[model samples]
Target: MMLPWALDVARERDIPLAVFWIQPATVLATYYHYFHGYGELIASHAADPAYEVTLPGLSRPLRIRDFPSFLVDTTGGEVGKVVNAVFCELFEFMDEQRRNVKVLVNTFDELEPAALAAMREHLDVFAVGPVVGSSAEARIHLFNHAGADKTRYMEWLGAQPERSVVYVSFGSIWTYSKQQMEEIADGLRRCGRPYLLVVRKDGRQEDVSRCLEDVVQERKGMVVEWCDQPEVLSHPSVGCFVTHCGWNSTLEAMALGVAVVAAPSMFDQPTNAMLIEEEWAAGVRGERNGEGIFSGPELARCVELVMGDGARAVEVRKKVESRKGMARDAMAPGGPAERNLRSFVMEVQSSDEARRKDTNTISPPP
Candidate 1:
């Protein structure tokens, strides 16, 4: 059976492996570089009051804000540790297209057309993406009777009135200061809306929730460690989503017809927020702390703007159609995604005999 040697067997059989990408094309474009000016670019942003960066090849101005948080670590980030510990072997397992294999990125093209175009010049990079959105149909009925009970979050939303609830979550990984969290709590209350907060399970809760105790104790609010988001957003009760503007969450909200209050933290998040507010007309940007929501009244105003029947509802709904169209086109049969699949098959077919003769490698590490 060669059960344990499945990867080797596949390589021997000339099966193509797919190395799906989730992070932005910009983050990855650096991998294929000998001189990306990465260090100088970061220094320029941090040093300049204008907060802009210009790299060797990019055409547009870079915001210190747009760079990924890992670079800011400057202190030899976990990337090095992770690279040595994990990616070293992982990258080795890949039979790179350099001109042969196919690269499947989960980002829709419109979101990063510039970087995507740059990447296409290098390899067979297909934009069949926002892979997260491929499951939209399943998310639409998120809280509908079936999975609601298991999530433990469905019942709470039913108790609120239509468009009266604001759901707050900063994604699976993001944090903020105690002072900033308190300010946002006050802002939400001032905005005069009922809210459900999904605070992180980390130690910051007690400090961050300093101002939330009164709201939590009262029936006007609820707080939990986690939530069933699609279920929560679909609830007739949730009026606005105060989110980190994650690509998946933003797209999922669109799929389920929920409005968003964008509060992007880092990485491509701000870019997503920029698109949501400036381009997509889907959400209003929230007051931001360096890597989290700035606590205060501005945060409150964002909640109110997107709540029930505001100026944004009509425009927001209409623009989502464009995004949906682009997203669907990527995943359609014989579209970019499908084309990548076909190319991958052909590559494997042509290389099977060569790989079978070489037994130096196998599967990626778990």
Candidate 2:
């Protein structure tokens, strides 16, 4: 959406512009195919969750429910209409600059090779991420209020058996409703696993403590406002991640080799969930009810399926372990992602040098 302004600024300054797509490359391909020819088909099947669309470059058919929410059921409200318009505009601009522009995505080549290859046919795409993992030495801590026992959760995790803890977090946004929180509490209790749940301070107004009072009292579960996500995911004791399926969270889980219990609600989350469960075979998506909530039983079932001593869990674990290696190789020295990023940097430097040379060359009596 902000691409136009950035492009204009770059052109005015006679500098090159590259679009940084924060979502997965598969998502970019989905939007591209939608604008090119699949829009009408997707729109016609907006109401049908079971309707499947096989896009040209993607490996699997995506059900309507697997698409980003903005691409489906946009007739319900103005928010959808506005979001759809923004994407339409963004892609229209992308079409115009297809030959000249480059897209740098926050994913690796090993993650979505098909989508990346498809996009490269139209636009210069670079896989320059897993762009997290910078040290926190430069981080400024403004909100440090975790009731002063900040290390308590880490301590609790240390005591648990390896691969026994169920870590649940729904990203930084989207507070859970009281009913949702209660259901989650019930699910965690029934699952009978030592769990760590993160409910941000704003969401605590619903009295989640009271909802999970029994679990907390029994020391089976611990609810904190927030914690270092990479640290938590990398913890030896952490087993499965019950996530909202945000792209960053998905990448973190994939890079760390943690099995996922995806509970996606909106936007690109469902698409990411599809990638996790269907394409990567690293997780199971929790089924949502008519009200778009994962009930207690359903959540419990999904968690057990991923984290239990079952054949499916074993399969998921093996796949997850393989994916961790793929992610590592993508970011390793001289790997595809690293090579692509280095080439992009060299291209930019070459362009800047040529521009400078041209500026310095006075007209020879033109």
Candidate 3:
């Protein structure tokens, strides 16, 4: 969304504006989630693993138990508040949302053909993804400031053995209570996998005293404020991601052939986690307590499930690997995503041109 706005601003300013997009058709399938009754039915289905219900638009029974945990939040709570705020903000940005809104998502039409088919109606969306594969190269020039250890992350991974280290990072805005932090730390320790944890420098009460140091010492580990994630995930030494299921992270993990353990925090994260864990068969979902508390043991189980060389891990790893080809093809020169992007550009320009032609502030007929 910001990308589109920034491009539009550049266009309005008559400055250089280049827009690239990936993923159009896949996202529309999600709008089906926005329809009334869909969320609840999905939730009802999720509450009972054997529960079966019809998807709003798609004519199929989405097993209740397999539904993403966001169904719990659909009943109206903090999650519902967030969803409502998004709709409110959508109203506020109704004009802006439409104004040259060139869109991209981290998915492929092959992986989400049904959703993508639904999205073709929008005309401005492009699905050019698994961007993380191209991102390490993309971030090469992002923060070349002095004293920045750009390659330090890479070097760290180089030191680890193959598929031995697990990389952990809660995306940009997840805050944990002190106990939750220790819970995560404990899980990492119990899992006994070599790991790295990136804790953002936010005011999220992090009292890691409870066995955090012990856990790190027991297994060779690294904890930092932040690290070049795409680089880390891309490394062969990195086997799995215990993630918040952010769209970028999901795509990154999938692109790098790193299995995901979805500990989704909020907003679209749960939905994204669902896509990864349920729809894509690329990850295991963490256990959420009745109050939405993600149990450390469940987190650990998901991690081991993804990292282990078991049947599930093999299945998920192959699924993730398969998505890479789809994503790569989507981003190619004249692929669907690229074609959609060109069309999006034309639509935005056309809409702008039409608005300019209709800008006359005529007074009402006297």
User: Top model by lDDT, which number?
Assistant: 2
Model 3 agreement with the true structure over 1-366: per-residue lDDT tens digits: 324355446546743333343322222343335343465555554446566755434424455433334444445667666555544343233234444444465566676666655554543446665555465445643323344465766677788889888788877667666767767877877788778887655524436544455565664687665677777877889888888877777777766677888886654565566678777898888867776677778878888788887899889888888876676677788886678667756766877777666765655579
Query: What is the clash tally of candidate 2?
Result: 0
Local accuracy of candidate 1 as per-residue lDDT tens digits, 193-290? 78888765563667666656665766667777667676677778887788888777876676556678887665567656755676568778876655
lDDT of 1: 0.62
Count clashing residue pairs in model 3: 13
Badly placed stretches (over 4 Å) of model 3 are: 1-53, 56-106, 121-124, 130-137, 140-153, 203-206, 209-211, 350-366
lDDT of 3: 0.64
Instruction: TM-score each candidate.
Output: 0.69, 0.92, 0.74
TM-score, model 3 to reference: 0.74
**Candidate 1 wrong stretches, greater than 4 Å:** 1-18, 26-39, 49-60, 72-97, 110-114, 133-152, 159-164, 175-177, 200-212, 254-257, 289-293, 308-314, 328-339, 353-366
lDDT of 1 at 3: 26
State each candidate's clash count: 7, 0, 13
**Cα error of candidate 1 at position 155, Å:** 3.4
Give the per-residue Cα lDDT of candidate 3 at 338: 76
Q: What is the C-alpha lDDT of each candidate?
A: 0.62, 0.85, 0.64
What's the C-alpha lDDT at position 320 in model 2? 94
